[model samples]
Target: MSLLDEKQRGAILRALHDLRRAAPARPGEQYGAPGNGSSLLLSLVTVGLVFALWYVATNVGWIKPLFLPSPQAVWMQLMDVASDGFADASLLSHIGWSAFRVFGAFVLAACTAIPVGIMMGVNRVARGVLDPLVEFYRPLPPLAYLPLVVIWMGIGEGSKVLLIYLAMFAPLALSARAGVKSVAIEQIHAAYSMGASRGQVLRHVIMPAALPEILTGMRIAIGFGWTTLVAAEMVAATAGLGFMVLTASKFMATDVVIMGILVIGAMALLFDLGMRWLERRLVPWKGKA
Candidate 1:
């Protein structure tokens, strides 16, 4: 307590307080600072009003039934989720299959992207060699590869996983590269001055410096991956929510179509939540994930 002046201590305390409070949301908002209950209530109220509008619009036929099913119709369909399976696959099965495909490809991307990105960061020669190729493929659309990927890999699980892997891999690699590059030159010098080896410097210094950027990239990649994953499933999948939605549309089972849409949305939300959890766990420096 006596080591610092009172004024300096006060400033430090304030800074710590602000840092601790800087979470994902504002006070009272969902995932916000600890004490902002008002914001949380407001968020809930807004969602409720949206639901109310939706219920009213459908029930009163303000919108045509074809265009917008009433809340009752949607609710009935949702209830049947437990009662009637989706396209011979239970709602649970659809979610499970979709999650499996997305996560499987995501794991592959992470494994391949991280090591190369780290190497790219530490080795100028590697960067020169890889950067051009990475940039070339990075801008291409993931679905653009569908035709060739199917041609090369066939329309089985291989094609589906390959599509998702392509969609997720480039962004992750770029992010890892950026993270590697963002490490301070002086930190590398300091490590060298301390007799640290190149590999050791990369592991202990460059990596930590680049971690924040990497996490940022991962969040973006995961979001892009989720969107592309649906398209992948739509192409040929028989069990995923996207397939169910496509099949339901063929017969105009609009209720089932809506249910599938909701299921996809729910799954996406769950993934986003999982990302938040990971961010919080891995990057405590980030405000609430």
Candidate 2:
């Protein structure tokens, strides 16, 4: 008995060792997963390389200053904008306006689209009704509808927000629908077997299962909101990063154009990072099959 017990324990230990060797610490992750530090270092290196290339190109006159401003020129313009303001508004005000427009539209879209998407995913009638509308408009560019929106809403903040909201809606809706549909049938069956009501199952299972996709949709929707922002702001008046960039372009202020572009990119990047952090917090089980 003692001998048998010893052999069993050795076998179990060896099996555990083999299992550890065969599987990644996080299942479905690559064998040599890069930690957050590694990813940050790589991102920094890439940014540094791009900056170096830009500096060298400008210094060597590979690209004309008019067409491609030097880093120093753009940086100087940034400082000027920060201190003295541009287009009758400070840099911070421009950012604030843009952020307001983008986030406001995004919030509205998420509120409406997520529910509509879930309905479409779960109900045949809802799918029939809304899917056609979404598909019909999804392929159309914001520019195509810009004039109509301006005519209807009359060059105000209402029109601008609506344009961005429309741009963000289809993607958010589609992502939610996909997420709901992707929930495992087995899970649904098990829930039913355990006496779960339809509402309870949805609340407890479907919503959680669909959350990652919904969050992903939110991220994509925000990106679309930003892309449509330039067009939306074009309708109107003033005081946004998009407006600053467009105004600069008309005056042939390439340095300001570049600065505005960099600022927009940085803000978008930061929002995306926030979305990623939110995803990790809300859907920790994602990609961890």
Per-model TM values vs. the true structure = 0.79, 0.90
Candidate 2 error regions (>4 Å) = 1-30
Q: What does the lDDT read for residue 171 in candidate 2?
A: 98
User: Candidate 2 has which clashing residue pairs, if any?
Assistant: none
How does each model score on lDDT?
0.74, 0.88
Clashing residue pairs found in predicted model 1: 23-288, 24-288, 25-32, 27-36, 28-36, 28-37, 28-40
- Cα lDDT of model 2 by residue, 103-132, tens digit: 999989999999999999999999999999
Query: Which candidate tops lDDT?
Result: 2
Global CA lDDT of candidate 1, please?
A: 0.74
TM-score, predicted candidate 2 vs. hidden true structure: 0.90
